[model samples]
Target: MRALKLVGKTLNFEVESLGIIEWYIHAIISYQIINYEVLPADTKTPIEVIIDQLSSLSLSIDSKNLVSKNYFQKMKEDKLRKIYPYFLKMLNNPSLSLSLSLSLSLSSLQTIKIIIILDIQIFIKLMKYLKI
Candidate 1:
């Protein structure tokens, strides 16, 4: 949870984007979850642990795929591929979706927008066949 505590000090750091902070938080939590916990963090153990701990507010296909790929490597040592399927099953929960959908709708906090946040100007020559 040391990484989670750094949320307050994020502005103090020289990071490029909020995503960098987010990545660290997720990485730390993933490291923890792989170590085995005592009780149900969610209705299913690790799934709830993941969403609550990692703030996985949404579960897009890419999000699910990315998470699976990440854990796949760690779980490979145990050769217990079953955990991946269990994780996916929890992500598929309809109730979980309903609850997760209630998450705060704050404006994105990305520290860098468009890398340089520039205003680009475009000049166009009129085309004969194009409508004005």
Candidate 2:
């Protein structure tokens, strides 16, 4: 019974650590989006790289630990389930626009527009999934 309790405590710690990591990732992404204009040009790529690394690490962890795999998978699914409505509302609200009309180059504007459209598409797909 002591061994079992030890296992339980370790699993709980791992799960909580994963949650903290995920929360930090989300917070960083949100901060970048909100402060895009002031961010350095190289900022976005590094964040993407970190996220990709984290994703691969998570996948490896999942493959090695069945319990953690199940927990993380459910966590991801639950986040997706809850995100669509909030995302749709953000897209629909003009006040929440990320546009910066501060004489940005045409290429920059185009990039921003493309990113926004892609996000909208993903959110729309999520909405459809929820409806089904």
Among the numbered candidates, top lDDT falls to 2
Worst 10-residue lDDT window, candidate 1? 117-126
Q: What is the per-residue lDDT of model 1 for residues 15-49, given as tens digits with 9 covering 90 to 100? A: 22112111232442453365333223233345434
Model 2, 1-132: lDDT tens digits are: 233235435444211110111123344344334533232233233443333333433222233432342333344433433332222223334343343232223453442222122234444453354342
Question: TM-score: which candidate is best?
Answer: 1
RMSD of each: 15.8, 22.8
Estimate candidate 2's alpha-carbon lDDT, on a 0 to 1 scale. 0.33
At residue 88, give the lDDT of candidate 2. 27
